[model samples]
Target: MRRLFPVTDQTAAAETTEGAPGGGDREWSLAELAAAYAYPEPEPEPEPEPDHGPGGGGPGVWLRANMVSTLDGAAQHDGRSQPISSAADMRIFGTLRALADVVVVGAETVRQEGYRPARARAEFAAARQAAGQGPVPAIAVVSAGLGLDFSLPLFTSPLVPTLVLTGAAAPADRVAAAERAGARVVVAGDGPGVDPARAVAALATLGHRRLLTEGGPRLLGQFVAAGVLDELCLTVSPLLTAGDAQRIAGGPSVAVPRRFELASLLEEEGFLFSRYRRV
Candidate 1:
């Protein structure tokens, strides 16, 4: 078996020569030594937003969520996202999670993604604490009529609070069931359905200014069509899955156009992670 080594012969020779005494045969000029030892200048940090006068609360922040698909546009492989995410992609996911004050998802996504709804690492907990937030960010689920599993880890996890957003027509029994499993239910829309725009306003009133939405496409399209989403973070996997499963956005064939400006693009392990802000 061949073992992998990080260091090369050139680096080894440099280390050995640098460690030799003045009596050694090799000698270097002052400029040569400085050039070899010079360190790259550090990049400047981004500026922080200044605090505005406190009267009216801050505007609601909306983040559109969707995973980057293959060239064929498939969000998952065999009904799961794990196959599409690499180690570096997982790290980026965690970093995005840390930046949000709340994590929002559609009820279908919560069930499909096998969501645990809590921080899986101590670093995430520590980061939340440092930001004067709870040990885990709140997990918010948007549902219109489907019943959720009360026994799931999302409802039972004591590390974070759960919020269920539903329409006015939601049954009292369903709300009671969610509450029994330690979730607060918020009624947002008229009749018996959830309105994405109203839900954003409700979340803002509940002190969740920085929101991150991880979606299952229908929700993403709804937010986009409603003109509420402010930003989008997508991780494009390299693999191809040719099948009629699901795309990043699913709905009627109607055209729903929304303008967005690219914020940044990152490539890792042949995968592209792109960030965009709504215009």
Candidate 2:
């Protein structure tokens, strides 16, 4: 069997003549076929909308949570979110990040995903520069107890300002540590733990009108229950994992059905991306 499948001396000659007409020595040049084939240039993407700058907007600010899940509704793979997306999904994610004034996330997600809170596209940077603003969007993390690594990219990056919204009574040492790491700490709640609703209000006061939350299920559920969320951008991946994994919302059971008015649906690479507005 090995000898039967062995490479022969005629292999090179066979390859060279494969595309030539009638097995002749002359080959078809690319120039000869150029007129028959046409390739169109891709359309340029539209410019991103201008987000309300710091302290420029009020409670009417638009808030959106962007997340992706498997067909079985699992947001994470083995308790992590990195495996739930493809390159196309990543490009969409970057576009959403670029369009937002602030990107909010949970501290656990920050630690788990190795979060770097900068806008990862040159177009976004150029837009900001054109608007006479900074190069990247602001990074906001919600930490009820201030439990996170100070040296993480979310806190240490000076190019993108980091905002930590926590309770007033959170540990002073942790607050100090985050401040030392160059994070702008905001006291959002009057009680012992951070209230996400109040945090949203505070962010609006700080001028983050177009806020985007990329979350784990717990945080998404909390915002959904609080009725503070305005828009939902959900991407449904093509694969399905039928086991128990964290969902897009996983907290106290909702009593009645909440309705969302469908805005748009886009399909790409066998994935369905849905946009909805709370009704």
Candidate 1 regions exceeding 4 Å error are 1-60, 64-66, 253-256
Top-lDDT structure, candidate number:
2
Model 2 backbone overlap count:
2
**Cα deviation of 70, candidate 1, in Å:** 1.5
lDDT of 2 at 12: 37
What tens-digit string does per-residue lDDT give for candidate 2 at 1-279?
001111345533443655532222333232322211111222444445568434432336677898999988899897777687876566567767766678888888887887886845665566556544456668888888888988977688757679998989989999999999999999988865778788888887887767889986778888888788888888889988888888888789667757898765545567766677788
* Residue-level lDDT tens digits of model 1 in 1-279: 010122356544554565442211233333332232222222443444567544443453555464657767888788777887777567666666665668888888888888887675565565456656676668889998748998787887747678999999988788889999998888889967888889898987887767778887888777777778777777788887898868887765446577788765555557766767777
**Backbone clashes in each candidate structure, one number apiece?**
0, 2
